[model samples]
Target: MLSDTIAAISTALGEAAISVLRVSGPQALQVAAQAFKLPPKLTPRMAHLVHAMDGEGNTFDHGLLLHFQGPASYTGEDIIEFHGHGGVLVTQRLLERLLACGARAAEPGEFTQRAFLNGKMDLTQAEAVMDLIHAQSTLALRAANEQLGGAVGRVAQAMQQEIIPVLAHIEAYIDFPEEDISPETGAALLLRLDAVLGRAQKLISTSEQGRILRHGARTVISGEPNVGKSSLLNLLLGFERAIVSPMAGTTRDTIEEIIQVHGIPLRLVDTAGLRESTDDIERVGIQRTERELERADLVIEVVDASQPPSGVHRLSLPPAVASRRILVLNKPELGIHPGWSSEPAAIPLSCVTESGIEQLRDAIRAVIATAGPLAADHPIAINARHKAAFERCAARITAARAALQSAEAPEFIALEIREALQALGDVIGQVDVEQILDVIFSTFCIGK
Candidate 1:
């Protein structure tokens, strides 16, 4: 039912060997025909070699023109693809020619949005499309692929299937009050609700790990002055990105770099030495260090192995930091004391000599692998929007449980269950309105 043609440059705007201009809609082929001065007698759904020209018939670039028929194309509509030399002016001219020929400029993610609206993909799959494109690591790519294959949607659908029958039973009782759909029927619904709740709870628990994979983990390096925090950062990254000097407080600000540790993305942050300082600049650095630690997913508490852990320290952090820290005993070359063993299973190493780097990498890998892969049958909630929706749905389910336990009327229980189902529908894109679709698609790049 789409009426107008849409066009956009699919590749990134920069110097490249080639750029693909994509067109989708009923007039996709016609728009390409107007731009490409090909010989007569060429049919639709065929690639034609010709000179692509502007509206004035001035030759721009010679390339191949491909046509796709409706219902069989990417957007589930007629489409055209122009493969031409990459040039900013050249691509702009071609798009302008098409726009003048009844084609409209595609909005950000308009193509994919069309595909979703045209029944080519559901909301979950559309979101996965972007996740796959922006994947920072192999683990993230794998999770996106799994969701694109409908793992998340299938789980939501299964939950809906379970709830539908119970709802139908309630409605049947409401319609026939004399029928023996008694307290036992309500008990059965409660049992079914518990089962669904268990499944949703499991998905919700994966949110933290899923988020870590989708958006790389934030790991910060923190320790008192002269503890080799900068050295450890350089060692973990396998490059001297941070300044390493003999002077204390060399790194006066936070330094960040993204690196792969066992195919998982880790956003490694190196902050200034965490210590009490009277110098104005050093004090500002210390304050920033505290804020970073508060937001860290993991903290590498580097202690100088040459020195023993003393009862009193300049940078005494909150107890929460201690609980979340993985102690790194730097400067093993200088030798460690027996008292260092009390510092939470420290990894002894010499960052200058790159000692124990592999062991440290392995430890980090173990932490992320805790929620590696859900079972083939269990679905994951990797998207933040879906996670929020599931949380709301879980709350409604909890309320429904209470209602059934208190022997509430069938109508009240049905309403609560319906509310839960609607929330799940929103997660899978079943309840998305035009406005929500606009927001989601607008976040995507035009070509995507």
Candidate 2:
């Protein structure tokens, strides 16, 4: 149990109808009673109207004091919440009073961290708390909620359970080498390891899509000057995010914004038109555009449908980005013939009339769908840390299976299985807590 009591303003610091300050620890009730002038009897899980007072016994503010008895609350400890007036000064004063009563200031994410430390939640679920809070799109929120509901944890636990038996069987063989194991038993062990390996590999494959959903995919819009790149950007954003003009080279710098397309979050970067230019600023913008292209997960190559076929040569994209390119023929509203419509994988769209915009959105979703279709029910590893853990676990499992096939010593196979178990443990934070806890908790806000 944590010895120190912690307090923090749980709500945003601003004037509102009410602001909440949370306190949790062993002495939560005693500390709150010192600052809050509660009724003669305070009931656990009940809210009471109370007057907040300072050390001098001076009334500071009136609010609702809610008490939660230890071992049944959010942090599995005594918790108190003061929902007071939203004035910044008033909230700060209330927090100060709590501190004067022996409550220390809570660090960023310390509350949730405490919950994790107390076995209320695993590391993946703890991470989902922040993911749900910072989710930018509906899909992201669904994924986060699924994870918070113990989706990843359940899968990891299942893997651990499967590995434990194999490890035990190998250990038994190692201990009693005189009792030579039958060939059938060895083959059964290999089969079990292969099943777990297959599952781990499948989960590892979803990491890319999971990452894209958590942190929006990096999408760079590229094409020649005056090909409706800015217009398409504004259309996709549903607002005028980028400057649009008939003149060429209007966007001299990359403008980025996060937008959701078909429930998938896209970190959209509208880069300057790719063309040779005499203007120094335009050249710099072009150079930056090239750099952005190198890092792009998906590139929207805007081609002017109104231009002749010869104009296609102007879109000189690097061969490296060819696989991720989506050829878009913009300006269909111009009444100009789309001569390049027959081109493979070319989406003709009209930014002015908003025609074929749905197709563009569908195309963007298609690129992500290649990894796997995302459903609210599916569990995914949303962070690179989880992905790395899965990868490591899979590698060990694969190696163990290979060792079994090669008829390697039982001790050697057991070592591989132990390493695999350790890697899986890292996923649910059963191991290496000190190394990853700080990094994970640091992303959360103080109140969480």
Candidate 3:
């Protein structure tokens, strides 16, 4: 029940300077008093140092107790934080005390969920709280912070505002068919709905960038055996993650490692060389390499520049990867074959001397920058939920537009508009089903 006093250890359990135990509910202060012997007279937002106790009232440790008053707290209820010693044992014991003192253990995300329910933030902002925590790069961090600051929510709210007026107008005519809307008015409604839908499509387009920010770009390196694929991987990762050997088929599996190409992270995979192999394991490895190629956002094909080039024919790639592929003529330190000059696009350098690695890194950064929509300082990186909501919202608006154009009953058009508005509510992360009805009742002036 929401009325139940809940407690959770906010900080990860480890030896740190301090660990914080969060308690929130109507009985937060009382629970804190039981666990910490906190004085009845307390000041909101003020930290008080007190000796923490267990259920038996035995002093366990000295800690700071901070109180947040109801209606102003994170969950919009009274909250108490116990800043205790960082030792894992001490933190666990302190938290046990909180639960023993009438506070139940909080479910994962309960606090943020409560904040959403209490009107502290909308769904997007609450989801962004986790995004900010899981941010992997500078761009990802900026996007998450922007979302947390209500960037996406504001967009949804603006979209709702645009939709509601049109919905209200349609409904106004539906309630009174005598006022049968003029075609000019119908055209204006279409324009207003188109604007809202255009914004939805714009947000929907950012889903790719959002996935890249969250998971990093899947960069797969492919080539024949002994073409220095592992060598390039080591150079990028600054360590020997994959074994390099003169023996063919030495690498019979894919090796993955993460490295930052500028600020964006590259989930670099050094796959088994693409080739025909008689051995079963080698053939399986080759098959896996093909699968990785199909899925890769970027494929870097390394070729031996020392060998006389037959032709500059790059490896055949999946249509998805064709535009994102980079051809590299490695081992230039050994001396580039004369025929290699024909292919100017392939980067030429030697892994033996670690030369041209910077250029390769620069190439990677370029692909990530231009290929992704996250080039802006603060991007609208919509997660899965937002993308689905935007799509649904856009679809409903499109349906409503079709109904309006066909001069279908105003009732059907208004129904689609209401659903579209409800879909925007999903974008905001609020799922109150009756909200559309509330808008209809409150926004329309029956007297008019």
Candidate 4:
């Protein structure tokens, strides 16, 4: 419905078999046809061989041209695509001619934004388009794909359906107090609200895992010096990403590598040995290591399996580390002994011998799976906006539940329900305007 026409180079700016120039709007075809000289038998919506020309009929490039008539294209309006030879100059000149023909350059994610504005997709699905494009792992791709397919939309819609009926029932009672509606009607409404809220809770739980998959889990491998932290990191990465040496101070700084365990991305951070140090540089490295452990979602606290039960037997973890710590008893080839049992919060392994690596991988996967799968065909909320909306909705639900528990007035519960409904609507763009739209679309790349 936008009055302006937009165009951009749709493909990545690099060498390829061909590059695409995308034009969308009411004047998309008209703008494109001005520079493209079509063949004799070619018609609209048909692919044709055309010479891309400049304003003075200077041939820029020869390419394939295809037209999509209004209302059936990606933007729900006329769209034109030019598949030209991939070259920086060629692509730029072709785009220039399109602009000279009155097409304006696209804003960041303006194409998808246009599609959203034209009712082709909602905000969640539109955002998912970007998520899918940037998904780093299989789990992330699955979650984003489900969201882009309107899985979350169906669930939200169903929840709204249930809520609307309850709201109607309550209003009916208020409208006709003489009717046979009992106070039990309020109880029934509360039950329905509970069910919907349960679903919301389940979805919220998956947000952690979805976020981990989207952003990758920060897992720090920490222990006192010479505990094979670097070796373990290399083994997990299945590559010599970290320098392994017999020297205790080989890795005096934090090193990071991305590794996938069962398709779950974990940003493995190998930090300097956690210990008291006299050297200034090593002290700074130790501080960085401590900082990494502080922010880690999961920590692998490595212990020397050869040592007896003593002060080092206890998990030497920073107070800031999360409670879910993995205790790893390294150097298992030295033999697991009674002393190993004395040490708590550990998983025994031999990084050099590759013993218990699979177990280690499974343990990481188990921790990730604890967050649970996202809702069925439900759009997993990924954007902060959607998360905020859900937060507000959750707050309203909490307030309503508290009202029910306190035997408060039914009107208060009804008000909370209305607030929850409106919050849910914002996620799907049913109740958004220019500012919210701007925030969402601004995250996208040009020609997305």
Clashes of each: 0, 0, 0, 10
* Each model's lDDT: 0.78, 0.83, 0.84, 0.77
C-alpha lDDT of residue 226 in model 2: 87
Instruction: List model 3 lDDT by residue over 260-287, tens digit each.
Output: 6777867899989867678999999989
The residue-level lDDT of candidate 4 at 173 comes to 47
RMSD of each candidate relative to the true structure:
7.5, 7.4, 2.4, 7.6
lDDT of 2 by residue, 1-448 (tens): 3789999999988899999999999888889889988899989889899999888889989989899887888898899998899999999988988999999999999999999888899999999999999888899888898899998888888888777767765664555455553233777888878888887887887787888888888999998888889998999989998988999999999999999987888999999988778999999999999899988878998888887666643555577566778888888666556567568678889887898988988998888676565745465745788889888998999888888889898788888988988988888889543433343234222135
Q: Which residue ranges in model 3 land beyond 4 Å of their true spot? A: 178-184, 310-314, 375-378, 431-444
In candidate 3, what residue range of length 10 has the lowest lDDT sum?
Answer: 175-184
The TM-score values for the models, in the order shown, are: 0.89, 0.91, 0.93, 0.86
Candidate 2 segments whose C-alpha is farther than 4 A from its true place: 176-184, 311-320, 431-448
Tens digits of lDDT, candidate 4, 268-327: 999888677798888899889877877787888887887765574344566545565777
**For model 1, the run of ten residues with the poorest summed lDDT:** 438-447
Question: Clash pairs of candidate 2?
Answer: none
* Candidate closest to the true structure, highest TM-score: 3
The best candidate in terms of lDDT: 3
Task: Please rank every candidate by lDDT, starting with the best.
Answer: 3, 2, 1, 4
